[model samples]
Target: MIIGYVTNFNLNQLDFNIKLKIQSDKFISSNCRKQYVKYLLDFEFRKNFHCIGIPIIKDPPKDSFVIGHHFFNDQENRKIGSYIFSYCFEKRHYVNLPDFTFNTLLILSHPKSGMLHFKDRNKRILFIKPKPKYISLCTSREDICGPIFMKQKANIIKKIDIEVDDNCEIGDNCICKNKTLKESENDLKFIYFVPKNTN
Candidate 1:
């Protein structure tokens, strides 16, 4: 879907000097105009410069800049036809919000979680949730840490345990490829830990 932020101003309301970039299948609608106004006045959301929208179309470009949905339909109800993502970078700096909103059918191809976990300088663990429609990897590293993965500038040392289904794959290029296992219906429920966790 075309994901981007929105504001209270209409196409005409915006000052001429202020520039907005609207991508394909994304536009401002009349139904949410007033809601955008109230959002601008809201104290809780004041810290956020841009208010995002969940577009109708599915599979929008990465980091596509968009605006002008005005007000979100239901901000309090976190699950309103929208998916929420929380991302943590360098063991800290968490970013969470509605991915994107626009005026087209939003067919979520991947159910991947935007959140990720990393260990050591070159080691990392990625958690993904897949959607029914698409087969591509749901989560991308850039979405969490921009373009490059830099370390040492900050010391991030933390440990956490995560659960996953037996059918899950680490990723096509994942170092954990050799760790894959095959289990039949007779396999018992269990948990396995990597060397890092055993330490």
Candidate 2:
């Protein structure tokens, strides 16, 4: 089933393309069962971005699966990033296992954003919130510090009442702050389901 849609395009063709990529992957073919393989395709038309997450498992348990998110820049025809993760069903919510690569930890450190994918037969995309432990790991990386600081700068400015230069404008450069920013809490609502048809 198609989890998301694109306007003015043949979904069958899009589905075919997704399947073709999976079929061509020898590792997925050799390790995962074709019949059980599921695809979560997300298209950000404004960004010209296409992301496909495939759960690669040889024999997935009824309540858990391992997935890898593959993101691509459609305009550039290049991959942006690919990160693998494992999730398991618990207390009616899917919990992310801590098994993550260093790069994956960096991506998760960004505030209020996490990986989205289809992990079940539901018609909504499962949004896995970033764990605080993972976010802390990113602070030690000098390269990622700049981008993360920039992304959260607006919030910092607000809290500190810092004055900005009149010449500065809030846009992609400065104003894009995390909408869901809140005090660090262990019980913050994490699991979110974005309806497939909303976009």
Candidate 3:
């Protein structure tokens, strides 16, 4: 979604520039366009520049990047493709989850109840639902810009009987070896890729 958005945003409609970088471990095999191993990839957009590098490929760490598919040189339909990512990083969203070891969640608490318990874990965190306007697809109902009224940031100074749910699963095309079991939740029962909340 973001890559396609960036492609369209970079070339056709907008004026400025949007650069993107994808770092992966596996060697991105290419026949014609030439994918450089142990080197940096460079893509030009207006005056701005975009680059992809081989950071994880050098050391190949736990929860690192992996090559998904071969390269396609599509000039007309640039950057229009299904992007399946296993790991992502946000320095701000980092929590010291001793057990959990993936990069996709931020444990938040209900604002009104003032109870330490969380609300529906799935709606606020798992799925992405958009409002009447289609721009903010990932925006939750509890979110109102940065200062959401229904949710707030908190740190677990002391965990009281909160039995950490350890229900984790590998992605459909997961290649990384050191995935953490703590990334799973207690209520995650999936029929194929679709999650079920029957529990």
| Best of the candidates, TM-score | 2
TM-score of 1: 0.17
Question: How many pairs in model 1 have backbone atoms within 3 A of each other, for residues 3 or more apart or on separate chains, i.e. clashes?
Answer: 19
Candidate order (TM-score): 2, 1, 3
Model 3: weakest 10-residue lDDT segment is: 131-140
lDDT of 1 by residue, 105-138 (tens): 2222212211122222113222211111111111
Clashing pairs in 2: none
Q: Estimate each model's TM-score.
A: 0.17, 0.23, 0.16
lDDT score for candidate 2 against the true structure: 0.26
| Predicted structure with the largest lDDT when compared to the true one | 2
Off by over 4 Å in 3: 1-12, 27-180, 185-199
Sum up the clashes in candidate 3: 2
Model 2 stretches astray by more than 4 angstroms: 1-47, 66-78, 91-199
Q: For every candidate structure, what is the RMSD over all alpha carbons to the true structure, in angstroms?
A: 21.6, 18.3, 19.0
Candidate 2 lDDT tens digits, 1-199: 5566767766553322221112123233335422122222232222322222333345555664433232323333322333232333232222233322212111212233333222221222212222211111111111111111111121111111222234423343231132332332221111222222233
